[model samples]
Target: MIKKALKTAFPYSIPILTGFLFLGISYGIYMRALGFSAAYPIFMSMLIFAGSMEFVTASMLLGGFNPIGAALLTLMVNARHIFYGITMVSKYKNVGKKKWYLIFGMCDESFSINCSVEVPEGVDKGWFYFWVTLLNQSYWVLGATCGALLGSLVTFDSKGLEFVMTALFVVIFLDNWLKEKNYFSSLLGLGISLVCLVVFGAEKFLVPAMCMIFIVLSLARPHPEKEVA
Candidate 1:
């Protein structure tokens, strides 16, 4: 079991390192610029626990975005986590006490790990899930800490730095798409979101797009039989 777990973890080690390092560093930079200290990132990652939200919070902090607005927006952005939990509830039943952690750690990358790996029979499913989650969250926290430090050094060219978060989303979207599940709905989401973006502009479009997607996708009942998709 240990050997197989190690073998499985091997393939993900590179991506897990690379993605988290750069992205975490970038977020750290932004957080520092927003007047957040080292403790901020640690607490945020530990408690707040949203990768994209952590980045957006930097902007929100700078802009004086209140808790209510932040919470609502966060719900909109990470609404997907709910779906991830719903799908995993059954697979995670045998997880026992670890089920809480499973729900808590259901971030984008964590979900990818949970959904992607096929556990060996008789191996501990809970431990596999826990380790994958722990590793990814470690990357995120490390990245954010590194990013905060790097932000102190590089002060310019942050204009396009925001795109890092978007790129991360694109990668996730592609990963989900390549699995041949939700590819169509994702395309529709892109189309509708783009149209909404052009129509309402960036700030105003997000809520509306989220609303539309929720209503449309829910009404469509996309691939109801296939839980993972």
Candidate 2:
């Protein structure tokens, strides 16, 4: 099982590793710029393990976002996972105790790649997915730690580095949208997020956007007439 999971997880190390290296450096840069030491992200990544959230964490910590506000923002930004997790219910049938870790670690990128791939009938899909999650996280930790170490020395404008993370999401969103037969649902997400962001700002917008997304997705099912045609 270990061997199989390692093999399956190897291919994923490339993308995951790339993200960790770049995003880790970005986080380190942001943290240092905010008057924090390099060890901050290293510790945070181990505990938090959420990339985008970690970026927000640096600012939140410095500005005193508070636990309640931080928790709310975390829930809002990551609310899409509730839907992502539903798809895994049946897929992880034989996983048992491992299900807990799986659910806990499931990220947007990990879920997308795992669900899209077909793990042969005899292979342990659970194990394969598990390693992918593990490796992805390892990359993040490595990137953050390494970046923080480097950030202490390298002195350049980190102002634009933060945008790299946002750019990554844009790329992922576009790639996913391109694969969808009808991206109308995705468009709805974009529109809803924008509106909520404008009205509620970052801290308060996540929950509203997430609720709106769920409502839209639930009601936006294809019409019976369209389905028949």
Q: How close is each model in CA RMSD to the real structure? A: 4.7, 4.2
Q: What lDDT does the true structure give each of the candidates?
A: 0.73, 0.76
Q: Which 10 consecutive positions of candidate 1 have the poorest summed lDDT?
A: 155-164
Model 1: per-residue Cα lDDT over 155-185, one tens digit each: 4543455454456566667787788744768
How many backbone collisions does model 2 have? 0
lDDT of 2 by residue, 78-145 (tens): 77788788888888788777787778778776776677666666667878888877887777888777
Q: Which regions of candidate 1 are displaced past 4 Å?
A: 1-7, 63-65, 120-122, 150-229
- Off by more than 4 A, model 2: 154-206, 220-229
Whose TM-score is greatest here? 2
Q: Could you tell me every candidate's TM-score relative to the true structure?
A: 0.71, 0.74
lDDT of 1: 0.73
Location of the lowest summed lDDT over 10 successive residues in candidate 2: 157-166
- Clash-forming residue pairs, model 2: none
